[model samples]
Target chain A: MSTPYVRRFDSFDRVLHGFLMLSFLGLAATGLPLIFSDQPWARRMTGILGSFEVAGWLHRVCATMLITVFAVHLSRLGRRLIFQRDFGLLWGPRSMVPQPRDLTDAVGHVKWFLGLGARPRFDRYTYWEKFDYWAVFWGMGIIGASGLLLWFPVFFANVVPGWFFNIALLVHGEEALLAVGFIFTMHFFNGHLRPEKFPMDRVIFTGRVSLEELEEERPSEYARLKASGGLAALQVPPPERWLVRLGTVIGTTAVSIGLLLVGFILYAVLT
Target chain B: MRIKHWLAFFSVLFVATLTFVAAKGPTNIPMKAPPAPSRPAVVKAPPEPANDDCLACHGDPDAKSDTGRRIGVDPAKFTESVHGALDLKCVDCHADLKKTTDFPHPSKLAKVNCAGCHQEKVAEYDRSIHAAARRQSAGSVAATCVDCHGTHDIRQKTDPKSLTYPLNLPATCGRCHGDPDVIKQGHIQIGNVSDLYKDSIHGKAVSKSGLMVAANCTSCHGSHDIRKKSDPDSRVFRRNIPNVCGSCHEGIKAQYDNGVHGIANGRGNDKAPVCADCHTAHQIQRADVASWRLDTIRECGTCHADKITTYRDTFHGQVTSLGFVRVAACSDCHGAHDIHGKADPRSTVAPGNIVSTCRKCHPTAGENFAKYDPHADKHDKARNPVLFYAAGFMKWLLLGVFGVFGLHAVLWLPRGFRERRGQAKHS
Candidate 1:
């Protein structure tokens, strides 16, 4: 029999994730050159983009896309809480929110990595996954706000002092560097580069996880679902062949570009 | 007195008037027209010696003077010359031989006086450094008419073959100015300006592009009236530099005239910069060139010492320091030709216009964006406390995060290796 699949993300979530990845990559590709404008490669990259002005335009466009994604994601959470009365999203084993269990999981995972203990069983979201999700909230808060200030300096000047623009520039560039560095390296590793996920983990793109993967990676959630008779409800037929291929193509392209950008950033920093 | 003192006096007065009339001759007649304005009597020029008369012997290729000097003159070349084109005869310049009827004129003829026809030009040349040196009796080998204009083959400057043509002037002047031996012998203080001009934008335009409008050696330095740069009347004198360059760059000159530096220069401030101060006198390249754009910041810094120190601290300055033009240079915001003080509303960097100046490069820039000080001194707490603190905070934040995470990554490497080994063993 074909490997059974369980839905990890809905179509809406998958599409939103796709937009998020694209916009984030676009922002990095355009913004990194400006921050490292002194590098020889930076000029070449800007030249490829037509000019620094064109790159600036592309950066703002991507920033708008990212902000829209952030807003939509927030509205969905708001709708779940207020309109749908879904309290489970805020606090539960299935919730993305961190809990005491996450602390224990992190400790157990480190011990297991050190060969001192058995691996911890994950629920719907692991501690690292929760960290990644929340880091976006933190990153978006800093980078997005400062980016807006920089984008509308004239409008903001009426409210803030002139030196605030200086601060905004500093914060915007530094926070962006931190975000890009983290997302490209640490996040890439956890999402796709770890030995278990070696080449990739396409669940984010295809919106499905194989039954075996669901069982092995999230045993606690699997046990809970099975006990509650929710496991069968979550099960679905395997994803279509073309859907998987699409996911592979998108995933591979993104991973390659992200790694290449990382290479550029490292070279710029080291030199 | 009273025409007739008496009948007896009438006779004597009549004789005296007649005697005066006789002494003045017919010119005193009442009917005679006023004597024509006195003029030197015009004597007809003596008939010029025919070219055939002189060329019979002088035209021979083997013709030589009694002193063994080559006296040969190619008849064909002279016929094609500027003076020949004017149909001048051989005796026109060689006036001493005008009356010589002998088959072989005396070899010792007076030196030809070009001043006879070109009095004004010769007078101008007499006041020049060349003529002054020639007259010094120190026997300085200085250029005269024949040195630049060929003896018999002289062509009009309009002709491309002429040595004084715009394209050929550099090399013609370079013959003496570029010669190391001439420079040393003449004690010329200005060394090899010819080579410097050849590499300049003006030189390249003239020689390589064949642009007739481009300035040649005689353009700034007058052809016959060239003076030392130290002379106040000189075209290249410090005070006259603007007007000299302005003769060609009119629009730039107008803009510069209204600029602070130009105004200061007008007020006789010797320190105020002129075009040559930043661009240099010779070896001037196009301002748009990357090297020139990058280097001009340092040129401006030579005077604005405090401003440059602060500018060097900014991102734009750092990028330029690395020799890139991708970012704004000083002139990008501050006007290049018409730069003004910030207090002046007309200034690009003035409070009212700074946003628009920034918008040149950063199109979306606004008042707040313009507030990002390009020359902010982070160390000057009194002037820029916010920048000082912000920069300090960022420095530590970067160090802190990298220090922490870098250690974590390092620590995790050993475990990663152990895990890989364990997995291999288990497999």
Candidate 2:
């Protein structure tokens, strides 16, 4: 029998994630060549994109999309807190926010990886997942702010000192490199390339997880939901085969592009 | 006494003979003298050969000299010539054959003297290097009048068929200048300048594009009195190059004259750059080309070594170094012809004007944005301490993150493999 599914993310969240994935990949693909413009591959890539000017336009368009996704995601959270009065999102087992339990889980998880202790039972969001969430927040502030300064340097010159441009240039490039490196390698590994999820984890795309997967991955949350009889409310019919296939295609394409971009970055940095 | 008496008588006879000859004039004097005594004696003038008389034998298609050299001149081409159109007689230049009554004259004749008619031009050529070389060497084949202008078929310089015409002048000069054998024989120091000019912007304009105003060999180097480049009066001489080029590029010359380099050059600073120093002489290319623009950075660096070194550290310099021209280059900020000291009010990079200069690329650039030092050197702590420390911090931060995370990812590979193996075993 097909295992029953549980809705982990709403459709809105899934669509926002899709936009985030696409825009981030677009930004990295276009921006990396500018940073490493001296490389032959950078020239070739820019040529493929028509010209450096086109690459620049593509980068700014992608940046706008990313900014839109960030704004929309924030507004949704704000609506939940203000209108729906859902304060549980701010602090709880299901919260994206870091709690004291995340510290214990991190230490325990590392210990388990080292074979010195049993694996930690993650409730809903693991420490790494929380880290990824907050990293985006930090990335948005630093990279986004600096990028705006560079994009509109003349306008910003009135407000800031001239030396600020040099500093902004340095900060924008370095922080972007850090963000791209983190997302492509660390985030990819944690989200999909781990032993259990060696190929991919499509729950983000399909917006649902099988009951067996939820039980195995987050046993504590599963147990809590069952005891409170909240599991019935979250339960759903199995995701359609077509939906799963669509998610797989999208998920695989994004992963492949991300990995390919990472390969280009490595080639540029190494040579 | 007898010898002395005879000597005196002979001297008196010689005087008498001289007096008689002076009074009688020549034996060929015309008997029909002027009726008035005030009119001078009219002596019979020598018979001259007409153009047709010379052309009778010389115009034959197979006419040859005693030594079997072709001595023929085509009548059709001669009729169209400047001298022929003027109806000049053959004896006008061949003055030695003027009085000759013989049907066939000597095979060898006196060389035609072009200076007889073109005295001023010949005087100028006399002072030229070619004339000097001819005077120094016995058998020197240095260019002469007939070498450039055709002997019988000479045409006006304005005519397109003229050798000295603007369009054909390069090839006329290139006959010797471009010939490897001639260059070797003449010990020419500057190699194949003709070939170099053929590929240059001016040469292509004149030859390929057929631009009448484009400079040729005779434009920079004067036609009649072309001198050695070392001669201060030579148009191509170092100090005179600006004026020579300025004759064509009036506006750029005006701007350059007001700039620092021009000012220095005017002050007799030989080291100060002139037009040829940067753009070169014969191999000059259009400055708008990407390769030329990139190359001009190094050309400028030839003088401003420190400035170029610092410029190379900037984002603009780095991008340009990679062969991209989207960013600003040295001349983009400094101004190509009107470059000045930063303190100068007219300078593009001056304190008051820098903001507007930055606005050329960044339309909304304010004073604060203009403060960005494009030539800031991170290694110089005293001058750029902020940049120095910031560059240092970023360097370590990148290395630290990559080092630690790289190590973590490396260690995780083994663990990941073992976990996967265990899962496979279970399955």
Candidate 3:
């Protein structure tokens, strides 16, 4: 029999993910060259954006898109928690929260990686996924804030020290490098590129997963939802083949570009 | 008395005609002496060609100008001259000697005619400012051939003893130029040109090298045809500077000719710089040297006033202003020889080319690195808001990131360690 499917992310989240992917990649492509401008490759690559001024224009445009998606995502979460009173998403066993079991699970996962223990059974989200989720908030907060300061120092100079510009330059460059590094390497591998998920896990892009994937990977969330008689309510038809195909195409393109960016950053670091 | 006047006139005219027609300095002739005078020895008359006769009176140590200044001619010094080499006799240069035999050689003796045999050189000298001043009645203060090269004591330029020799040019030109009395006459200021040259890179090289090859008074300024700088034909004229400097620096000349200054000058802007405007004429300093490096920035500031101010405010500019050589300066990014305008695609400071230009100092530089404008004037908000605010925002972001994250990591590490131990014990 064909496996049943469960809706993990909604259509709104998937659409937001698509925009975030494009904007992040755009920012990276147009932005990294400036950071590595001394590189022959970077100098040549920046020409693809027409000129430095055009590149800057595109960068700011993409930055605006990214911040918009982030803000909307947060607002959606706020509306759910404050108005709908969906404490289950925040505090229940299926919630994306740092519980005592999460600490044990993290330790257990490290032990498993080292061949010292059985693997930890995840819920709806693993400790590493939560870390990845929160990392965006952190990266965006740091990178975005500093970027705005460098972007419009005169307006803010009335409230802050002039020397802050130097500090901003340092932090913006270094923190962006760190964020790019984490997203391109640790986040990509854990979320999609791991052997179990290879060539991808399009749950975020397609908003669905098969019954077996949910049962095996998030057994606790599956069992708890079933016991509460809410599991059937979450079940849905498998995503359309065209939607899956589109996700594959878009996701693959994003991953390929991300890998290339990581390679450039690595080269920049070594040489 | 009439017969005596007739004899003097005929003899002087005969000598004058012979002198003008001679193609070269007159050849020495063994003169036939007049019949020996049995009269007192003091009354004995000398023979023709008259070298010894004139030398006997005028070459004496006590021979004096009208002001009683000694004007003695040492025979030894004269024999080394080109005129002396050809064995020219005294009457060759003094054609009117017959008229000067009466007692004190009339107040004004015939002037020494260097132009007779040196007609080509005199023609060149006539075109020079020195000659122009004399012609325009700037005074008899202007230089003449004899002023630079001694009258009877002149020698071949190759001989170290010659006044016109390359190594001796500064002193030769300096004699009248630096002479307070001559300067007071107001033809040319000279402005301690000799002293300035002596302190210059060219001067030090010439002095230390002890060679005629190093640049000296005659190198930039033509020897026989030196003119005022305002003359278009002058070697030091604004339009001619690149060519003058290019004589020795061919590569730089080719580069500079395509540069903005060279282009400006080509378009007839007199205010545009040539080599001297920055390097200075008599006091050129080597830019690679210490003090000269600092002065080079200041020299460029002479033309680009506000640029220097902006450049100095940048990190590179600030360090350079503090005399740091490791940092970049005006010529570093703009280029020393090939400097172009910002609109030019080849300009090092242009949007497309700045990355590579800055790469000289910052090897890791990317297009973003070039975005850090070296000429960014902070006061210009509209132009620099992006860079300006980016810097300000980064400061607080860093503080917030470290503050929240530092606390989170502090809380997470201990809890995770405690749980790991508890899980191990429970198992």
Candidate 4:
């Protein structure tokens, strides 16, 4: 029997995710040592990066890539909205926005988790996915802004108070930590680490989900596609096993690095 | 089969060795015992003079000279001197008198050479700058043995009556150094170094505190072989400063030997400072004192112009400039003696160790806080654009994040509670 699959994301989204992962990892790897420069391990890590000067260079390069990738993503979203006139992509169940149904789905899921009601059947997007998506806009804006301020303090200082520099340092470091912590803990678990998805769900990387996975995770979306006669048009050959394996390696490495960083950060915060 | 046989043989050998080792060890080794003292003591009188008849006329109380100067001598005072104690006669020093048979000498006597008896001291004096200056200028500005120690009344330095004793050294050296005629003639600024020494920390200790081990003139400069600092052989030479000071300041010298400046000096860099450069030869003060520690900043600033300027703009620099003594200075981070480059792991200012160094002033400072460079200038974007942008980004981010997140939290908390209540009703 021919295994069925559906395209969940296009190549552009996968490339964006790749860029983000690489840049985020680059930034964290080169940046944390600077934040905790007095650590012996931090010193060794900086030595590997070729001194604080080299680390600074790596950090600036990664920061530029991160900023560019985020800008490209927003521009793509704009182009979709303005040129493509995909008004539906911005709202409702198909959109990355919260809706009336999403609230019910959230309340229903809570009841299920609490054992008071049945689990809500998610469509194209769940309330958690919406939260995750919306959080990026806020986090990226905050982290990016603070990063810019730190990168051009003298110019900003001429226009603003000196205390702003101190504030920038605090926010940039704290927000970066928050982002790393969340992506490592909440996002990893919800999207990849949970038992149902353990080891991973490779749709984000391969841009395709197995039919069985689609049916199990988003039965409502499957039923809606069937009802609208779009299911047949979306169906394609299942992703190659090697592609899935490649994603496993990428996902596992990314998550492991995240876990390591989170563990160190927790130690710093608690201690 | 051969390996097994060898192992068995080795085991037997090891067992035999263990048995021998367990036996009691011998305590004694063949060594000769030292012999006891055998010399006998005997009562003896002072050596008899070669010519007691010379002292009879010369040591008289009413003796007169051709220049009308009294030549009176005190018998007891003479007996107490080093020469008198040795029972030397006047003719021994004045050898020309032995040639004279008449009461009045036929011709004048040649100048007596102290080297006739004090050969080592005379040799040392010959190598001295004073001796060189005397030969160059052909003048009496050079100090001979009689200049520091009187010819007829010379005493051992151990004696409290000696002019060379620690307590009397300042006065002895200052005699010629304080004289305006000697200063003008020799073209030397003598009073500044020796005369002012009497009012310094060492002088005060020697004069008032009765500190027996206090440094004196001869402590830094050799008495017999005193030379200008420009001479490498001089005790006060710049290259020999650490050793000269180290004789007394052993601990500071040990610290300096491991320091960057000391390491540089060891590599033959003449630019590096030695003891006398920072702390003057004569007027050194207690380094621990607040006023004196403040002076060290200016001294360090002399060589590190750019660093001092940046440091002055820092919080520590501002506080120090305002006369606050407790603030951290260059020596506080880069240690006073054990200073090294930031790349050196042992360096106090190295990235890995900077936190502890900072904690000296900021007790609770963490690695994060230490990341804030005290000498960094936010006004120079060309050097540090990241810090500049970070500051601006944080300012606007704080305002936007607070405005948005603050509103979100304010609305969400009450909404969350309402949603829970609604869920309860539905359930």
Top TM-score hit? 2
Point out the worst 10-residue segment of candidate 3 chain B by lDDT: B32-41
Sorting all predicted structures by lDDT, with the top scorer first, yields 2, 1, 3, 4
- The ten-residue window of minimal lDDT in model 2 chain A covers A164-173
**Tens digit of per-residue lDDT, candidate 4, span A100-142:** 9987987786666555776688999888777767767777898
10 residues in a row with least lDDT, candidate 4 chain B: B32-41
Which consecutive 10 residues in model 1 chain B have the weakest lDDT in total? Answer: B32-41
Provide the interface RMSD of candidate 1 in angstroms, 1 decimal place. 4.0
Candidates, ranked, DockQ: 2, 1, 3, 4
Q: Mind giving the per-residue lDDT tens digits that candidate 4 earns over B324-427?
A: 45668888889888898989999999988987987787676566556556665545577556666655665565456445434533443444455557556876
lDDT (tens digit, per residue) of candidate 2 on B299-327: 89888899887776566875675567889
Distance from true location, Cα of B97 in model 2, Å: 11
Residue B287 in candidate 1 has what lDDT? 88
DockQ of each: 0.23, 0.39, 0.03, 0.02
> Which runs of model 2 end up more than 4 angstroms from their true locations?
A47-53, A84-88, A98-123, A193-196, A211-232, A236-241, B1-72, B82-152, B171-212, B223-240, B264-272, B277-298, B301-329, B359-366, B376-390
Q: Could you tell me the lDDT of residue A219 within candidate 2?
A: 93
lDDT per residue for candidate 1 within B276-357, as digits (tens), equals: 9878887789988888887788899989898887776555775565556778888888888899998999999889998888
Please tell me how candidate 1 rates in CAPRI terms: incorrect
lDDT at B239, model 3: 86
Cα misplacement distance, residue A45 of candidate 3 (Å): 46
lDDT of each: 0.80, 0.81, 0.72, 0.72
What does candidate 2's lDDT look like per residue over A204-246, in tens digits? 8888999988997799999999999999999898888898898
Sorted by TM-score (best first), the order is 2, 1, 3, 4
